[model samples]
Target: MRASVSTGQDLGMPAIYLHLLAELLNTIGVDEQDLLLRVGLDPARLQSTNLRVSQPQASEFVTRAIIESGEPGLGILLARELKLPLHGALGTAVMSSRTLGDAMELVTRYLTLRVPHLKVSKRENGSLAWYLVSCGIDLGPLQGFIMDAMLFGCVSMGAQLTGSVVDGLRILRRGPEPAYFQRFRARIPVPVEFGATENALVIPLARLSLPVRFTDDQLAASSRAQCEEALQQLTEDAGFACRVRRVIETSYPFPPKLARVAGTLFVSDRTLKRRLHEEDASFQQLVDRVRLERAADLLRNTAMNLSQIADALGYADAANFTRAFKRWTGTSPSQYRNTWKAAGVGKKTAERVPVAG
Candidate 1:
């Protein structure tokens, strides 16, 4: 099977993430050298946080690590190890913010430095605050692992910032409830709602102003300066393909409209078009890429059939999904699955109706 949707371009993720995964493996008494190699990453090189690897490399690494370690809740475990200073200057800035609200503002502003492939923002209504998140690329089967880690990381980082649980916080996760969701709840005592409209952390508005225990105006100012510069550099370094891909990834009900995606990104449709042009990409290209990758992942990872897979991928019908799949891979969906099954590898997919979340 293809390792990931990405073409092994883009500095995919900071080396720290892969390294942390390695540590997670170590803790579980599993050897990680082969897992890293499966994705063209060297175990030794991951020791330096400055190194970069392609998005596919990181995604494949995570998938393989999860399979090998038999830990579906790897994301939650990884989040626990990401304490302060682990996020670099972004952590410094977050640590010194005046209050939980301020820290969150800084986090939404600078989180890209830690994980550029995602966009998370904070929105407030009358009595609730939402830490809304959207992916910048298709995560395929790894979506659960990635989203779990990110939401759980937010909880962990929140506690570090405020020196408290930052009470009255709950998680709103997209997709069905995986059995592993409880791993996150175990680490951070918070309510989690699955099959939600979006991926977010819902908080009581009252908790937003809780004081950050170690706020320092001077440190925050300096760290913010560094974070701003780093954000600019990383923005260009990471490229916009993943950013656009993320829009496709998080759009619920399969594909989202281009104008809607632009609006979500806080840009005019025309501007969104122009920016994608500069990246030598387009909305349709990203949509197809995400859809195709997700289709393959579903076939390989889930027991969903062609029709069910088609529905999940936003196809109007199985025939349409079959045509698209053949065009994308040179073979039909059944052909692809049969070929893999014949090879005696991949997920042990069986016929079963998916349970309602």
Candidate 2:
């Protein structure tokens, strides 16, 4: 399978981040599963680190999560829970970086791999270095929540990378501080300044040389290579074909029709076909790709029988599903499940296993 999607437009937020937000909602006594379903998102899809939820869907879900949880500071809470490894390859690259400066540079270059809407730019002045963060899209109500998660997440990450909070670090926010910030202010390691010209993380120039706690030169090189490849794939996947795939991936009733997928993307059938062809993709190919992925996941993780799995993937019957599975993977669905089970891999482990294209 391809390591990442190839380029045209912004693909969307990584599903893992949304999954983390859902977990936060659960901790706050909200029915996160229901909230996701109501927003037309599949809870299962969020489990895949490699998948991305479309921007509109992700925006709606986050908006509702805030309203339902009645917590505007959920972003800060979310940041506190962001362990380094949850960031995927970027996390690995950062963790294994030689110095805080190197890690921050990696983040500035490849943050789009994780958060499509946000970008970080570096500016240096006498004695101080500022990492200014700005959003590429109009986040509106989500602006505060995202900024809180991002800037605080950086603070959290920095503390994790270095054994201590680097001296003289601070956070800058553009608007007046929100009322809820007081609840988190005590836990935040760095001082925050409000009513600033831009949102940024400020640190002394000398701190940039602070060595990362877990730096490994070999791991750093390999992971940075992975980040570069992922970045390329992400940029390549931004085209019309990718947008259509996003629709199909999240659509209800499994294996959505071409017209439905096209309509969802606001293009007619002919135009959709032409655009996808321009990207060297086809409607059925995209649908098959999604089906194959879902099929593999269901086979490995669920005890659902072939018949049930067939129905789930919109196949006519078990035989058809089995044949399709064999065609896609060179093995039948039952054999696939048995092989995975025989390996003693659990559902959680299976879920983390990236499917080859």
Best by TM-score: 2
Clashes of each: 5, 10
Any idea how many clashes model 2 has? 10
Model 1 TM-score relative to the real fold? 0.63
Please write out the lDDT profile of model 2 over residues 148-224, one tens digit for every residue. Answer: 88889998899899988788999999988889889989988889999999999998999999999999999999999
| Candidate 1 stretches greater than 4 Å from native | 1-11, 182-187, 238-357
lDDT values, one for every candidate: 0.74, 0.84
Residue-wise lDDT of candidate 1 within 2-75, one digit each (tens)?
32344322435667777888988988987887666555455655665554555555666788888888888888
Model 1 clashing residue pairs (backbone): 12-55, 135-246, 136-242, 136-246, 137-246
User: Which pairs clash in model 2?
Assistant: 1-357, 5-233, 6-236, 6-237, 7-235, 7-236, 7-237, 8-238, 8-239, 9-238
Model 2 TM-score, 2 decimals: 0.85
lDDT of predicted model 1 = 0.74
